[model samples]
Target: MATNQEEVKLFGVVGSAFVHGVQIALKLKGIEYEFVEEDLANKSDLLLKFNPVYKKVPVFVHNEKPISESNVILEYIDETWKQNPILPSDPYQKALVRFWSKFIQDKIVASFSKAVRAFNDEKEREKNIAEASEALKILENELKEKFFGGEEIGCVDIAAVFVAFTIPLIQEVAGFEFFTAGKFPKLYKWSKEFLNHSIVKEIVPAREPTLVYFKARYELLVSASK
Candidate 1:
């Protein structure tokens, strides 16, 4: 294969924050690629084949080789494209950026999931939501200027995107609030701007389908906890 733009393919799961985050990065870099939607429930052969170890979506295929993990794929896309750079070139800045991204992935994302999973248990759910909000406040104060990337979208912004795009829908389904204008003014404002960012605006998954999927999933989890 000659390896034109179309040769770059991404295996994605619908309504997935990780998948959507990578897609947002690709669009930011002005990269053209095919997006293959994977049914995570059924576990597609293509996904399993490309990401055998994790057996997950968000496998970026370039020249027939697959890159697993959204953040790793994001850096790969930035390095390969060399336009609209995602990570800061300065070593210290780059390290700082990576630290925030890692924080989002390891700490924030898991908190959101735990909070959602505890929907049926009000006390557990409230505690988790409070912890998540405290964690978010760190990001809120970190936004000294326009984005996590300063004036442009960057790696940290991409990594913490779930807080901007998905949490509202999760709030709707779980009947709890974390990212709110009252509680996190800066983060709430960032969410609005993030959703309206030229590339991000276009790629946010449809609100209806996302709400439907999350609502159904939440119901299943809640029922199971009973």
Candidate 2:
């Protein structure tokens, strides 16, 4: 299929938080791409073919070359498009962005488990909360300025926004709130501004639908635990 610009096809569900990162990055770069929604529960043959290792969503296939992992896809989108760039030109600055992105991904695992499963032990619950808090603190410091790096919405800003937006909904489902603005004032402010961005606003899923998604995931998680 010929695209107005060279065709770029992205495979993932709209509500997948990682997919949202790619969607926002592509929009920011003003890239024209076709979105193919995948049924994660069903495990599409295309996804399995493209990413055999993880077999996950948020797969970016550019002219048939497949790229998995959201952060990798973000980098690929920015580098390929070269229009509204996502990463900084400086090396040190770029490293800073990667640092936060990795941090967010790491904490996300623990947070997801905490959000989905029932914690019978107070010790385990405390451990999960501590892990989440540590991650949020790093974000708070990174967003001390108006942006993750400065006045503009850069790669780090976009990467962290996925966590900020999704974390609240996860908290809602878990019946716990770990992201207190009081504890992480800078991150809170940055999240408010990032979510308020016109591009961000356009792509953000409605809260109700997000909550429903979380509830469904939580149920599956609970069942898996049993």
What are the RMSD figures for all models against the true structure? 2.0, 2.2
* lDDT tens digits by residue: candidate 1, 3-107: 454488889877888898999988887777888988777988878889999998789998789999888898888878887899989999988987888888777
Clash pairs for candidate 1? none
Best by lDDT: 1
Q: Over the stretch 1-226, how does candidate 2's per-residue lDDT look in tens digits?
A: 2356576889988666788888888888777788898887798888899999999988999888999998899888777777878898789977877877877877854565573454456677777778778877766765657887577788887777656688778778777777767888777777888888889888878889888988888777767777
Instruction: Estimate the overall C-alpha local distance difference test score of candidate 1.
Output: 0.84
Cα deviation of 79, candidate 1, in Å: 1.1
Per-model lDDT = 0.84, 0.78
Query: How does candidate 1 fare on TM-score?
Result: 0.93
Per-model TM values vs. the true structure? 0.93, 0.91
